[model samples]
Target chain A: MDYSKMCPKFESAAELLGKKWTGLIIRVLMGGPKRFKDIKEQIPDMSDKMLTDRMKELESLGVVKRTVYPEMPVRIEYELTEKGRDLEEVTNSIQAWGEKWM
Target chain B: MDYSKMCPKFESAAELLGKKWTGLIIRVLMGGPKRFKDIKEQIPDMSDKMLTDRMKELESLGVVKRTVYPEMPVRIEYELTEKGRDLEEVTNSIQAWGEKWM
Candidate 1:
């Protein structure tokens, strides 16, 4: 949690982003903000509990922002903040590598 | 294993690299080829079993190559492949992000 003491930056960042569903969650959000169900639609295999947990982690990291709209049927949406958008390059690079290697 | 079937690139790459300690292992190797003990020295908290397992996975993924010397004691070293070097940008990006955020 205390990444400041974690020495190398890549090591801390990787530890934070290298969780099972964390990358996928960020990739899906890269498409822009989405409602909870929409995110679920993209990663169908992820269980509701796992999604919630990943979202919480991302939210805590300031990568994802949660917004609620007061409506007849409460609406909730999750979007990447400015900090999260900085990872666009990282997402793109990993995707390119995966295409060529994996 | 079949990342092609996984759709998005980030999802597959993350699944492959997102496991615990995988990122740290790659970061250590980025300093150039290193013996197993040297790599272990960089990440003192990682268990031998986990390090061995991560090395095996990276080897299988072709990101890392294992070589054994024919000399007396048979020295072993792990080096990143050409394909692995392509990840330099990703590593840099994550490190920058970690420095700025986490």
Candidate 2:
């Protein structure tokens, strides 16, 4: 989507991260690809519905990838795309900022 | 407060910026000190009550400062404290991260 044209006129850069849960989701993804339960384990407070919704949103946004392995239980895993991996710097910055301000 | 000891166990940094509106408020304050109206102008979607609450939260957190000038109109301005300004780097990182992920 041409997010630049979106109303409220946030910079394309700002609009993406402005959404709720996106940052925290990305932060957890930093630890590496994990199954649905692994991600869920990391964020016990986030309901399964919310986590699924955020994962879909992140995937649609082109920052996260979902992989399903052909197993009896059909294991599913999530990892950052190359583009998503680039977000590490910003995450570090956020962690740093949170340290000082939060 | 000794936020580090708070339950749910967020890093001290994450605890601060993780709050709703705190990040956006800091993002706006990056432009410089702003009056109540000025800040509101920058974020028309935010209600007055919410903005007031966020300012108080940030001030008490020691990341933002409120200055009241005894003028006819009774101007009250808000700015980032030194610790607050340090958040700029983190903000920049968030902006950068948002660019890739969102």
Candidate 3:
């Protein structure tokens, strides 16, 4: 995402997190660890396809992690990377701002 | 805009600023004041209709202000509102994060 062509920080920020399930997915993963089913349970409205797509995008951005376990059903879990963890502070501020104005 | 249903702050934040021209529009207005033409000049890729729509949306959100001067050659300029001004600090952090990461 070469955002230098654009001056707004929010443009790239939005592009990074603006996808349909991106933010909510991150918020869900913030809990620590979760499986595909667990994430789907957390967001009942999200389609399986969209959730999968978002996970791939976050993983590519180095903001999320995916772990697989050999099991009867082939269990897998998702977690936030260190870079993603830092977003807690920023997102907290965003929450404060949202509650204040909106 | 009612984001209480979502724990992810970025969801709401993205929704508020994630639209096509939303972020770039805010970034451009950060300079101080600009007219419709000035904004278009700043962002050559933006279409007139999109610019008009974005200005209306920002104005309604109380993030951008529109000042119009009645004259043969009408003069109009957009400035950031107090609420919008507060975003400067937040956006700078976003910029830093972007440069650090993607």
Candidate 4:
């Protein structure tokens, strides 16, 4: 991440947000809190392992939160935190730029 | 590349711009055109091979242009195209977010 000697902070952010599938995972979660199944549904091809890894990474970074509820059946959901929501500008810009160019 | 299944354009753009070292390379070039040595000076650890490969990829995608001059020194430089420059917004936003959060 420190490969970018110009700006270590920016490089760190790029490493987190710029990894393949990371941005899209955040984009999907941005829709709202969702169950694991729902997230998997939206990203049909993502392996369970990959999804779990990304979620754990995001969660550890304080960008995403995971909630567990007691019920007849165990329930879990993922949603963006306030800090994560701040990335809206980044996501929107990327989407807009992609739509225009790609 | 289309792992998102949400917006292919955005996914494509992310794949191109979000890869390791790609964003920083563009960030450095945004300052203006520079020779291979200059770019290397800014990003010290990047191997010559990696820099060459990224430059070739960006050049092929029309985001970067490589100019050759028939001078005594055989001058060569890399610069962002209009399309590439448009990414300034993306770079700036990431930098801002990084400085604030990271």
Q: Report lDDT per candidate.
A: 0.81, 0.70, 0.72, 0.85
Question: Best DockQ goes to which candidate?
Answer: 4
How well is each residue in B1-102 modelled by candidate 4, as lDDT tens digits?
232347777768888988778988988888888899988887788899999999999999999999999999799999999989888888888888898889
Candidates in descending TM-score order: 4, 1, 3, 2
Q: What is the DockQ of candidate 1?
A: 0.49
* Tens-digit per-residue lDDT, A1-102, candidate 1: 322233566677888788888887788788888888888887899999999999998898889999999997999999999999888878877887887877
Ranked by TM-score, the better of candidates 1 and 3 is: 1
Worst 10 residues of 1 chain B by lDDT: B1-10
Interface RMSD of 1: 5.9
Top lDDT model: 4
In CAPRI terms, model 2 is classed as acceptable
Instruction: Tell me the tens digit of each residue's lDDT in model 3 across B24-85.
Output: 76767777787787777767888999999988988999999999899878888899998787
Writing each residue's lDDT as its tens digit, candidate 3 over A6-33 gives 6554456656865666767766777778
Please give the lDDT score at residue A21 for candidate 4.
Answer: 81
lDDT at A3, model 1: 23
Clashes of each: 0, 4, 0, 0
Candidate 4 ranges beyond 4 A from true positions: A1-5, B1-5
lDDT of 1 by residue, B8-74 (tens): 6556777887889887777777788889988888788999999999999889888999999998999
Tell me the docking grade of candidate 4: medium
What are the per-residue Cα lDDT tens digits for candidate 2 across A5-98? 1223224454455455566677778878877787766667778998898889888878889998999978889999987888777667766556
